[model samples]
Target: MEVKKAIIPVAGLGTRFLPATKSMPKEMLPIIDKPVIHFVVEEALASGIDDIIFVTGRSKRSIEDYFDGSPELEMHLKQHKKHDLLEKVQDIASLADIHYIRQKEPKGLGDAILRAEKHVGDEPFAVLLGDDIVVNEQPCTRQLIDIYQKYGRSTIAVKEVPKEKISSYGIIKGKPLDHSLYVLEDIVEKPDVDKAPSNIGAIGRYVFTPEIFNCIKETSSGVGNEIQLTDGIRNLNRSQKVYGYKFNGTRYDTGDKVEYVKAIINFALNNENMKDNILEYLQDVLASKNNA
Candidate 1:
């Protein structure tokens, strides 16, 4: 079956971003001219997902408004004959058939995902983590969907992170099936470097079968007293085939401040209008620092 629906978990408190995130959602933070959530939703649309289910928190009003049509703004743009800008604003509102429901509490990734059960029904669906921004030739979720279709089972995106950073991510220990695919073995969530199963860290992109909800329900909370999705995947792997694919892409973890700035700079350098100016400005700043 073609994966036409996606569940996006955007209900996190985004505590790391503090004061700026005090009144607005971190997902709404501007990447340049556009917000972070804009890129994420665009990725889903590019991946052939027509239906989107957003698991939202109480404070995420800005998120809802972004996707909602702004009639006054649209009217002003149209009256001013800003045709190009008007099309872009209208496009955001009509991006997809979006539905949202409250998470009500801060549980975990697993719980946020479980909330999408009713909307997703019995078919297999993709789950795209909000803060993971993957710039690739193909959308990350689409890459996972291609693998899921071939294997007829669940597939998770993996990347080889440094051993020192192993504890910060869910590390997987699995046998190699192909150059980029790994057979299911075990996944350890935040294991210390010495005890980590392997260097292959599971990233945020995933295509899961409906059966995964049951596994998540059976999973017990770990680490931060919240139900971790990695634990759910470990439990799911017991009875079914779960594979990991080393996806082709540059993934930016926007949840971290340093990485977020890097993402902004990297994206700006590749942008047509901003590239030359941003690069020259950065070079001048570097030269001044060295001279000082």
Candidate 2:
């Protein structure tokens, strides 16, 4: 079956981004000119996803509004003859068929996904984490979706992190199903470097079958009393085939401060309008610091 729906879990309390995130969602934070979540939605749309289900929370109304039509702003732009700007605003709302469900509590990733069960009924769907932004020639989710079409099994996006950083991610131990695919055997959530199954770590993009809802219900809280998604996928692998794809891309964890700043600089330097000036200014700043 063609994958037409995508679920995005955006209910996390952005504790890492404190004070600033007190009133605003971290996903709304900008990387250059576009918000983090906008990039995520664009990725889903680029992969032919027709419907988007966002598992959101109370303060996330801004997210919904961001993708909705803004009549007053549209009228102002139209009257002022800013045709190009007006078209861009209208295009945002027309991107996809967006739906939202409130995740009442901060249960976990597994629970966040479960909230979308009704909307995604009986079909395979994709899940894209709002914090993990991948920039490449091709969208990251599209890469996973292409793999899903071939195997017709659940697939998780994987990437090689340093062995020392394995404990910070869900580590997987599996055999190669193909060059970029793995027949997942087991997944360890945050294992010590020495004990990690492999350097391949789950990076937040997933294409899962409907059977996951049952596995999630059977899974008990594995770490931090929070129901982990890795546990459910591991259980699903026991009976059904689950594969991991070592996706190709530069992924930025915008949820972290340092990486967020790096993403801003990298994106800014890549922009056609700003690239030359930004590069020259950066070189001057570096030269001044060296002389000082």
Candidate 3:
């Protein structure tokens, strides 16, 4: 079965970004000019995904509006002869067949994904977390989808984080299925440094079989009194095969304040319009700091 749908969970109340996110969705926060969520959607589109199900919440109306047609803005751009900008704005809505389901409460990732059950029906689907932005020569979700095609099972994207940082993510323990793949034995969510099973931490991309919905339905709430997607995936592992892929990419954890700022700086410095000026400004800041 070809994977044609993707679910993006963007309903989290980003408390980490406090005052800014208090009014705006963290997914709306810009990396440079484009919002972070746009990159996730762009990746899904690049990977041949036709339908996108955004599991969103109340304050995330901006996300919906961002992808919908901005008639007034488009008219203004057209009047100003800004053809390039107008096309860019118009392309957002044209990217995919976007559907939305409101996650009524701030539940866990599992709950967010479950919200898309009706939209997904019985098809295999991809899940991409809005908080993690992955930049690669090939899309991260595409990498997992390819693995799913080859193995005829679910696949999760993994990357080796520092041992000390393993406690921050769902750590996996598994032997190599090949150079870039692992047959996962178990997954430990937020394990302590000493208790961590392995340094291979789960990234944002996932390709899941339809059987996953069954596991999610039966899954009990784990930590934080919330249904964790990790727990559901672990349950799915028992009855079916779940593999992990060490995806090739640079993942930015935009949910973190420091990382968000770093992403802004990195993306800004790489922009065609701002690269030289931004690099010069950065060099000046560094030189002045040393002189001081």
Give per-residue lDDT, candidate 2, residue 136.
82
lDDT of 3 by residue, 1-292 (tens): 9999999999999999999999999999998789999999999999999999999999999999999999999999999999999999999879899999999998799989999998899999999999899988899999999999999999999999987678778999888978889998999888999888889999889999998988988888877788899998999999988999999988999998888888888888778899999999999999999999
* Candidate achieving higher lDDT, 1 or 2: 2
Poorest 10 consecutive residues by lDDT, candidate 3: 162-171
Candidate 1 at residue 216, lDDT? 92
Q: Give the runs in model 1 whose Cα sits over 4 Å from its true position.
A: none
Which residue ranges in model 2 land beyond 4 Å of their true spot?
Answer: none
What TM-score quantifies how close candidate 3 is to the native fold? 0.97
Computed on alpha carbons, the lDDT of every model, listed in order, comes to 0.92, 0.92, 0.92
- Tens digits of per-residue lDDT for model 2, 1-292: 9999999999999989998999999999999778999999999999889899999999889999999999999999999999999999999999999999999988899999999999999999999998889988888999999989998999999999976678889999999977888999999988889989889999989999999999998999887788889999998999999999999899999998988999999999889999999999999999999999
Q: Pairs clashing in candidate 2?
A: none
What's model 2's overall lDDT?
0.92
Please report the TM-score between candidate 1 and the true structure.
Answer: 0.97
Error of 2 at 11 (Å): 0.3
Candidate 1 weakest ten by summed lDDT: 162-171
